[model samples]
Target: MEETEAATEKAKDLIRMGVARAALLEPQDKVEVDVVPSALIIGGGIAGMTGALNLANRGFEVTLVEKEEELGGLLRYLHRIYPTQEEASDLVKAKARKIRENGNIEVLTSAIVTQVQGFFGNYDVTVKREGKDIPFKVGVIIVATGAEEFKPVGLYGYNGVNIVTQLELEVMLKAESFTRNNVVMIQCVGARDDNRNYCSRVCCMTALNNALILKERNPKAQIFVLYRDMQTYGTLFEDIYRKAREEGIVFINYSPQRLPTLDKGFVNVFDEFLGEEISLLYDLIVLSTPMIPHPDSGELAKMLKVPIDEYGFFLEAHVKLRPLDFATDGVYLCGSAHWPSTVSESIVQAYGAASRASIPMSKRRVIAEPIASVVDEEKCIGCGLCEMICPFKAIRVEEKPGGRIASTIIASCKGCGVCGAACPQQAITMRHFKDEQLLAEVMALAEGT
Candidate 1:
């Protein structure tokens, strides 16, 4: 800790030789408590809000950070929600109001976490808001930074005026002035395709909801929903599928192997159910697509020392049993960033995440199992191989003034010994998962020294 403060001061000296040493640290190292704190909840979306509310209710001083100016995320943009047809803004506003009123919840809107430098019980969090750096130490972290809406700009010329995504369609519907008579909606544009092959899980229900709205407004309007498969596989959704069909909304089936074609005024698509190619004149086309992860996920994963799956979903510690937890002891994940889920599903996930967060609140302090690694910085070459190999981003190279670079950050280190396997100089080793633990057994088996 002394060396960390010294190195930080020295680096600042380079930029301002005359600035006093007192000004170097920038009030940047905030300890949530004078001692290390128990937890941090990232994002202010549904999952994050739920996690914070739960953890705080259980007696933890929780910090909830949101990158957006507002806390509700996608839910805020929605006017009315499905099945119940309840006003979406009303629900989000209630949560936002609850969070603000809760004394235990520390809300940070338009804030970003620049650094998450510690592990389970001793994480050093650096948050930036309005040019001020606030630092805090916490025992746990909850990653509920939900997903961004997918954009189909290139594949089908979605950038045009009439062409819009499901999110934009929501805005139009909320505006209550859409006079679209021949509205055509296309499905599976950016999802379940060759490049991105996972079903988004909620597009069908969304299309069904909007179709009902169109039917209620302009009775003569022709609303068309074209899709390869309608995956309404959950409770209440199947009922919605029937209601859409009953309301005179036309559903067309198409082979995903082929692409939908559009011209200046006419749209051409192969109607698979009808076993024929057909053309239709339409005023507007809405693309019902699934949510995608934000572009900054890789950077956030690195800062938090977490792993993202091949499909770009953040990999939790366990799939079913620990559905909302990361591989680390004090970190958790939930919502669209994990995968496609409905508004209700997101709310439920937020609630579960909050319940999980309550565990840390019940405890006064956190204790990490002592299987994690430590580094011998004296011999570290700082080549950045072990840095890359540790999927958790636990290894970081820090330059010390008037000395060679050093590698540290014990709090972010997981117990995995893979970093030792990548070291040419053998400078890094997990405390309990030491190389000698395996080496001695191997030597005895080989009958060699």
Candidate 2:
């Protein structure tokens, strides 16, 4: 389709910028870019990288900015991705190679977007990279920051003793052989209860993977995975479930209705299935907790004007049709930054998201919205209320020759016209509404005057 071809061309453009950025970076700067990006992909994780690469393929110049010291996100910590159990690092390395080959994508590690303004088709993003701030004029934005695991320290006594998280287990699996002959894994330690109701999709699967590995390591090992439900949907995954049972792995039905207790050397869980209470002894306890969004998600959502679900995941406009795209036309969301997903799922989403970003490049460039806020120079009072109230931090509050003041930076303004609403002196008039034009509408809506 025409859309697909256009996407490819822009993808190439962004990749060229990537090489340029790498060469010009300063000593502390992990990466640098001078290009006015066609789209900005934030988070640099699986979703971010996939979005960047796919957008590059579509011929969009993409700037991938990550807050972490390196990329790969959660995939870096995993020993192997499940179902396939493929080497996680090898997969990440391969993606890194493709990212290098793509000439249209530029990467910035250890970078944080401090200020973002503009809307849909045109936005100004200010980022801090290596202690220096940089700004970019972008046509689109994609958020793929991903999620972090929760520490159920109290529930499972996971104080780094025998109690550990799925990630910690991965590390221990590689470091030293666990002495526990009987390992009991508890699922949903911090998810899908009254607090977090959404199923994390991958926790059950991850627990299964770990249990199977533990059993494989020691044929005499007793691996028990306790869960409310075992959701092994999709083709071939059912086979994985069957294999786990064949390997002598035991699964017990647990309840989120009551809190699970951990004693000195055993787990005291009610036998909801057997209609009684029971205690299971184990040397190690793995808490397969659900992933939670970063605590700053609320602030980030407000700053970017992005919508988030009540539970904290970035809420996408349409679950299927828009996949990575937000309800807002030019914004996109990806990975655990939005919701939980496996590396394979995240990578697929990354591709879908980045591919969607090629729209701006099809036109070669974008035009600024004319509906931005405007100051009436003569009537304007330099109180500087608009500058500070802007969530995007786009306003430039400046003093004039006298005590009088004025403001500028229209491109950074989203044309939301919240400033005009906030202005007390009524000196600011947003485009499309003049003084008389506003009065007529207000009067029409108002009760008879």
Clashes of each: 6, 23
Q: Candidate 2, residues 112-133: lDDT per residue as tens digits? A: 8898875545577899998899
TM-score of each: 0.82, 0.77
- After superposition, candidate 2 runs with Cα above 4 Å error: 1-37, 101-103, 117-126, 134-138, 175-180, 194-197, 235-239, 309-312, 317-323, 327-329, 367-375, 384-418, 428-449
Report lDDT (Cα) of residue 65, candidate 2. Answer: 88
TM-score, cand. 1: 0.82
lDDT of 1 by residue, 1-449 (tens): 36997777666544343232223222222122122445677778877887788777776788899999999888887757988898888888888888899898889899999998755566788999999999988877888888877888786668757888878878788877776889888988889877788888888888888888877888888888888899888678898888888888888888877667998767788998778888878888889877888888878887876788766778888897899888765677888778877777877887777677666546545444445566787778777778777766666667666354436445455567788778898888766445554454444434421
lDDT of 2 at 158: 73
Model 1 residue pairs with clashes: 30-135, 37-139, 38-139, 119-411, 305-392, 373-430
Off-target runs (Cα >4 Å) in candidate 1 are 1-38, 372-389, 392-414, 427-449
Candidate 2 achieves a global lDDT of: 0.76
- How far out, in Å, is residue 220 in model 1? 2.3
lDDT (CA) per prediction: 0.76, 0.76
